[model samples]
Target chain A: MAEVRVENVSRSFGAHKALDDVSIAFPDGGFYALLGPSGSGKTTLLRQIAGFDFPDSGRIVIDGKGVERVPVEKRRIGMVFQNYALFPNMSVTDNVAFGLSVRGVSRAEIAGEVQRALDLVQLGGLGERRPHQLSGGQRQRVALARAIVIRPQVLLLDEPLSALDKALRVDMQVELKRIQREVGITTIFVTHDQEEALTMSDRIGILREGRLVQEGSPEEIYDHPVSEFAATFLGDANILRGEATETGIRLGDGTEIATRLNSMVRMTGKVSCAVRPERITILPASAAASTTGNRLAGRVSKRIFAGDSSTYFVERDGQTIKVLVQNAGQIPFDEGQDIVLTWSPESTVLIRT
Target chain B: MTSAQAARKGIRPALPLLAPAYLWLTVAIFLPLSAMAFFSFMTDLPMAGREWSLTLKNYAAFFSTSLYLTLLWSSLRLGLEVTAWCLVIGFPAAYVLAKVLKGRAREAIFLLVILPFWSNGLVRIFSWAMVLREGGILDTALNAVLPFTVSIDLMYSYPAVIIGLVHSYVPYMVLTCYLTLQAIDDSLIEAARSLGASRRQVLRRLILPLAMPGIVAGAVLIFVPVVGSFMEPRILGGRTGTFYGTVIEDQFVAVFNWPLGAALSFILLAVVLLILAASAPILRRAQQ
Candidate 1:
């Protein structure tokens, strides 16, 4: 268990830059997730930290020691690839024992360690089966067992749960978090799924075009996004683009939505106000007078029932905003009905575009 | 008849589609093999230039001759030697071609490997003869560099036969191995390395096991063809290069003893089949 610090790391393949001076630090015994879309250099950054790839510029340090010159085998980094990469020719026991055997561990020790690793992943007594004989989730667990059996300082996982179905993925996510907590190993998980990052990571580093855009806890990132990209990528947020004024930002429709001028808007000419769908409350036209705070007169454009919650698409001044209401025995409103939408000022975040 | 009954009475739908393939297989493959098997059991009439009667005398004559047994042993030894040599050289080359080369470079290298096969086998042997003969290219080149006169009669020898067979069959080994190597996922090797395996460990534990199928397949292909080859031993094998294939050729073409030749051919067939059967278990285990 060691802290991994990457400083100004950049990598390029010919003219196409894969990583652009990305830098982030993962503390010891914490789960750090590099979250981004495809081609966003999250995997590249993870590989660089794993010693599989060398940065063109800058340094990667683990526990205050430079690891750039270290070979992947010598780096002692445990990596679980997206494809699992289990040795298909070997049985599960042999696969898990590979790292220990390579390090010249005794046969008796290897047997005990292999069994322990298998049990850690809830796959005890499956050592005799080959990778092809296992299901996707089982194979991934085998891969995890193989990686963690070595007990390296840093555990690198590159989209390990991406191959499983939704239900299995959720189950495995919980299992992975439990294993990490039990072992207390410093783990870096690379993924594109926002929900997985939010659920599993102690700190989520959101990357965009090979750059580290934001790094914070899940709640911090989701509630206080510093940029429009970060806010939109984390989840669905209503972004109202407007030009800043002395009073408040004026919308394109000449309607001025009053807001407390934030430091971000003062520095940047353009600003975007983001509000979560659930934060916005919808009131009937007849009960519009009863609502308080930032209110907008709109008509319900669309209504959808999502089991426990109902979503209303409200249109105001040619802008469509989604409002989510919990199903608590309230009569559902019909589409095209007039309503007043209101939200608290604290829930709205001002972002610079 | 009613329309439905007429339709039912027509020819089977799949028969016409399969007819041409079955006809070709019978004419081109089965008929020749059946003739060869039939001739092995018959007594040859030299006067009539054909077989006279069915008999086991030909097979009996095979075990009775020590000279025939020696030649058969020589053929087996040469085939095994050539196959081993091809595997040693071709496996590494195939590994590089499959894992290292990419795009146009890979295609270019593959083409270079196959280019030699486009030329005739006899032509390649003749070219080797020019290099290996006394006062030939190799001898002349050695004489120029050394003070003593270097004259090695290498054109007709067991080594020459092995060399020729290896050269002829190496491309086949490389191609088969390359296909197998290409099918392996590269991430498996990376995973092995990240798991604390050294370079040698990775190759021995991961690569060699995965590539065993191709290696076995190449060995069988090279060994089978070299054992049955007549032209290489005749052209390159001198006094020491005499093999079972040449003796079988002599019985059929030179001495006009078709019964003895058929018997010798059957012995060769049995030997080859025995080898294949013996190696089948090893091949199956390697693949698994």
Candidate 2:
């Protein structure tokens, strides 16, 4: 519904800076996720946007209007807390209608709108029940319905699906995306779960140590992480730190694993390349001496089978590289056996660090 | 014993473990209440030499006595006034203690609020006389500070009774409300504000409704005791403190009317029960 832009925001608690000169522009009607580890200032950024906490020196603009002077009550934002803080004293209907009721909307309109919101959440006909009567997933839906009922320009969700169990969380994630799509509200969600951020958001911003480390589409960031921290944090990446050469970086053992150098990296100094486990294929060393294209020889130290796919830990030059192989009819690699690992140049991400 | 057999034989140790407490409560509470109810129906104490009978005369006497009714009304009004004042003063104090104060300061301040309850209640009431009576600490302190000398005689008055009662009961309100208010998630308030509920609206719709159980518990704890309080009014209110409780005290001690006292106490019990029953639904919802 509206674009939210946070510009040059810096906030501190005592000596510790929670957010440091962080800037990100959330485009209109796009579901953007702020992803970071704990104490990385992702939640702090979300709270600043919601007007719950003000930045020490920054500008937060919502719908092209600067909101530094406006309080949360007058800012017309909607928020879903991690706990789904529905008004326990109110029925589900009343909880959904709370924003409208506070704004002095008519009773008839509030009832209709509340019902519509509940229906949008697929929780219609349960408005008379109190919050305690609802299950955890139901409470989550109610929290979402309550937030969007007032048609807020920006919806803020702070780890909303973190409380639900795995199955329920997966189900609600789809439900949440559907509701956000239907409403077309500019939603900014704060979550530390990498899979949830990657699967849910249109754009993902990764925060580290109070700074925005990377902001891009999930695929872009995953496939072309600019820093070692981003590559390792966003997903599991086997980082190969070595000296840069004309084509790629050479490991300490003189194994030149050639990879495409992204624009972020200059081939003049030491660099690192992150190769995902699933991107590499494992082959017996006897069958791999003649092959080229980023190959490594190692003994399989550990093999983890998970029915459909298997993860093989390959030890090469005192370092372990993980290779994931889909389970078809091929013979599984045994632990302690010599294996050859190979991945294409495009799958390897050249890290700036 | 095997675990299965031990489970099947659940009452082996549990009953004996709980017997002492149940016995004490029965002797200390239930038996006396039953005796009081019985006494309310008797014409006189059942002395072996005297002939006594179960009668409705005491109940009838309460219905007929205009003086008793007026005193009961006075006591009810006193309870209401004291409860209101305690809430007005206590809720904000509780809010500050629970929400505003932090770390070691909150614990220290909370202890300070409850410090008076550590001392004897009667001593505390009598101490107020020194502050409220003419030529007392208040009079001396005020006269010393003011340019014009002034009399500070607040003793032997209705407000004096309210002050003492409020002073005695305010901690109950604060303690209960602090627990509930502190338990409230901070996110709920933030969520309400983000949804465009102003500070006042947040307090009215979210905070107050969520804290109702504590408020109700405090009101009940204060109102019940204050309604039956004879010592506080006697010490602080002086002659103007002839409440229903004081009148009942007169029946037992001054008038030597045991049956009438029992009846009055029973009527007050009924009133307390009625009040609790009236608010049970609201309190139940709040607890949920």
Q: iRMS for all predictions? A: 1.2, 1.8
The CAPRI class of candidate 1 is: medium
lDDT of 2 by residue, A55-154 (tens): 9998999999999668889887889999998887788998999999999999999999999999999999898999999999999999999999999999
Error of 2 at A159 (Å): 0.9
Top of the candidates by lDDT: 2
Using Cα atoms with residue i matched to residue i, what is each candidate's TM-score against the true structure? Answer: 0.93, 0.94
Best by DockQ: 1
| Per-residue accuracy of model 1 over A1-353 as CA lDDT, tens digit each | 89999999999988989899988889999999999999999999998888887999999999889998788999978999999999989999999999999999999999999999999998997889999999999999999999999999999999999889999999999999999999999999999999999999999999998899999999999998888889989988888888876655667776566554465436347767788898888888887465555677899999999899998998887889988899999988889999888877677777776
Q: Runs in model 2 with CA error above 4 Å? A: A288-290, B1-14, B37-57, B278-288
Chain A only TM-scores, each candidate in turn: 0.96, 0.98
Candidate 2 achieves a global lDDT of 0.91
Model 1 achieves a DockQ score of 0.69
